[model samples]
Target: MNRKPADTEPVTNAPEWTVSSLSGALKRTLEDAFGHVRLRGEVTGYRGPHSSGHAYFGLKDEGARIDAVIWKGVFQKLRIRPEEGMEVIAVGRVTTFPASSRYQIVIESLEPAGVGALMAILEERRRKLAAEGLFDESRKRPLPFLPEVIGVVTSPTGAVIRDILHRLADRFPRRVLVWPVRVQGETSAAEVAAAIRGFNALPRAMNGPTGPVPRPDVLIVARGGGSLEDLWSFNEEVVVRAAAESAIPLVSAIGHETDWTLIDLAADLRAPTPTAAAEKVVPVRLDLLAAIADLARRHRGAMMRLGERRASDLRALTRALPSADNLLAGARQRLDLAGGRLVHMLGAGVRRHEARLAAAGQKLARLSPLVLLERARARWATAAQGLGRGFAHGIERRAAILTRAVSRLSLQPLRLRAEAGRERLTIAGTRLANARAARLAAERARVDNLWKLVESLSHKGVLARGYAIVLDSEGHTVRTRAAVSEGMALELVFADGKVGATAQGEGAQPATRGRKRKSDAAAPPPVQPTLFGGGE
Candidate 1:
């Protein structure tokens, strides 16, 4: 068999790519194929937003799952935020993450799937607002019986406004402030809310371009009938909150009577129609006038009847009174009887005075001055005797008290107390002295132990154990022989002291050798070990 040369090799046509290139190609292909798509699926694995303000989640159906991401800007603009288990239709471009080698959808816009989803969202919002007490009946205000200025929030061109105006005219006319706004669309809710707030912000009455613009006394938010989607603006949280926070009474007349919105719950009154809102705000002018007239007539008649009844009572009282002549006849008879009794009373008084004079004379004789003086003297003498006896008894009682006090006064008990106090003082002083001595001893021992520990850990201890340290002229430790050079200034520190010397090369001999030999020959000096090496 013939083998091909080593340099000769067979080659086939095939494309080559790096991982990044392949990923890029795949991403471009996927994006070009599905530039934009609307996918309806149930959201899953939604764990809210990341710290980066971007949201990550998965959209899955019964069988398949696709990763989804919402950029911060896009997520903030979304009307309906994606929640776990929520069914929504996402509109965005299909893209790939090269790092993870996965395909995902970059969501730009998201919304609930259909009417069912919308209803679910609506119910959830209702429950939330209700929990905040915004929809409570107690929070609702009563509509003004007669509003001077009425504000209508609706399209000025719509028939609803015309109906309201005509009805209000038929009943009691009022100043109407029309805040024209879009009835439906993306800006509908915001426009309506602004209109409500604008009306509230207006001064009670302010000058306008054409004429005076009076702030609305009663606000009527009215619109013609429509489906739930068309009427959804009234159900927005902004519009409902505006109605709830309205200072002036508000009437909600949106859609047909059967169609309910959240604003109706917060409004002061819910009219079935625009015309009904008008009727409810004001009473019928003619009927009111007629009622007033009837009341005036009844009041006048009642006052007249009261006056007549009082007059009759006065006449009856006058007829029942006694005749003046008859009254005078009785007075004359009493006067005559009084005159006859006056003479008899005068005679009896004189006789009674005589008897009183006789009794007074007898009392005067019995109370003579001499007899009174004698009686007073007898009483005085008796009192004097009683006082003497009392004084004598008081003196005897005081003497007995003095005798008892003298017996209780003694010196023996005081001496015993003084001795006991002295003994207590002595014992206290001895205990205090012992305690002071013990504290001083303990402190001394502690200080000695600390001093010993410091000595053991210090470098001085190493020097004392026959070890010496060598330092350069700069006082830096010379740990290796290489750090030394010929003629270098050196320092040697031992336990006893530090010595300065000039370094000599290894071949140099010691200067003290001759002196040391002479001394050694005379005394035969015992050998002594140097700090690092023995003498040569």
Candidate 2:
């Protein structure tokens, strides 16, 4: 090989490279040789996650297998998780692992190969979240026209935040709180989710210690535009759920206009870009001021036109009105004519009224006040006498009542008290006498009733009523026919005496309870003629 000693002092025998140096050279050669390349293969043996957040897996086709690794950053930015047997196209540079003497592609970006695998996963998640009403239009809140304190959840160092702040400043200066978070990579989804929740959990009012952060009236979750892989954190379920559940209105400015994430659908509002989100939040200050001025101008012009129109109308009315001088002249003419007539009429009327008044005065004078006064005085005297008599009667009656009351009151002393006791005793005696008399009356009445009952029940009484009592020879009463046997002797008692009797071989005849029967020859009642020609 020919060597030239020039520009760089001759490269000394290609510099004896050690193993580390050789590996270094190979790594650089591989990286530069491959540059950025895309390859498609099926993922295999993807066990799960590593504590360091890197993923190790195998990419294989039917013919060959190669170990592959994705660093935490690149793996987290992947739209869909790498599952075993998924076909993916990875874009990255080839690098070697010195210990294992193996080469693999360090995936810078990854996607489903010739397939909508990520899209399918995204759609599935969307459907699931939508079913849960997370994406409901009804749940979407209206963004506040101007937030008091706007919270931003994004990478603190990104241009997105700068763009947002600049736009907001240009439109309307607002109080903004930045919740610094990772916009992409492994912890980005979790950090974004945590930031959203933290903003929501902040106290609404800051009277006391507001702690490190005050609650935001509206939250903006934003990131700059990139590949779907770059925006994958926003699509994460945790991030989307956090956005959906935020009571504070959330604005999703996730990426450029064409880039959409799950958070965009879940947020209260979606801005095409971070700058656009700022614009959406508040109107341009100058524009608002101009609008106000225009309204004021319109209002003033309207008022002026109204006032001019009213003034013109007033002028037209004034022109149509009769002159004050003419009105006064007409009124004066009428007043003059009426004044002369009124004066003439007044004179005539006064003369007539004066004549009538003279007559009336003469008539009134003919009536004597002395007569009327005398009559009134006479009536007054009668009324006065009556009133005096009534007063005297009332006084006498009152005096009598007072005298009685005084006399009664005077008697109610020692002697009167003793007399009252005696009176009470006498009253007790009287009540005792009345009670004895009532008892005597009741006893006499009872005795008289008993006597009457005895007399009524006596045999003499029964005989007197034409009834008899029968007795056996032994003097026992035979009350029933069955008790009287044939040939048995019986005794009958009457009010005056008793008689002996015998049963003539037959039971005793039943005594008739009524008076002797009276009978006549059979004869029918005479028939009477009916007025309707029927015999009765």
Model 1 alpha-carbon drift over 4 Å, by segment: 1-13, 45-55, 71-81, 207-212, 316-536
Give the TM-score of each candidate.
0.55, 0.41
lDDT (Cα, tens digit) per residue for candidate 2, span 1-536: 98866786845666687998888889889988998888889999999869999999989999998888899977766766777777888888888998877899888877777537677667777999999999999999898876888999988898998998999899999999999998977788989999999888888665546555568889999999888778878888999999988999999998899999999999999999999999998889999999999999999999999999999999999999998998899889999999999999878966865675576556544433333334444665575567558656765675566556657676557346546655765675577558756755764565455446545644567899877788764444566676666777788888778888888755556444312222111223233222222333
lDDT of 1 by residue, 1-536 (tens): 99889778878698899999999999999999999999999999999999999999999999999999999998876666787788999999999999999999999999888889878878888998999999888987877778888999999999999999999999998888899999887678889999999999999668989988888889999999997778888888999999999988899999888988999998989999888988999999999999999999999999999999999999999999999998799899999999999888878866765675566556545543334434444655575567557655655665466456546756466446545654765565566557656755764565445446545655778899999999765454666675566777789999999999888879433333112122212332223222122321
Candidate 2 backbone overlaps, count? 0
Candidate 1: Cα lDDT at 430:
67
Residue 83, candidate 2: how far off, in angstroms?
7.2
In model 2, the Cα lDDT at residue 222 comes to 90
Q: Candidate 2 clashing pairs?
A: none
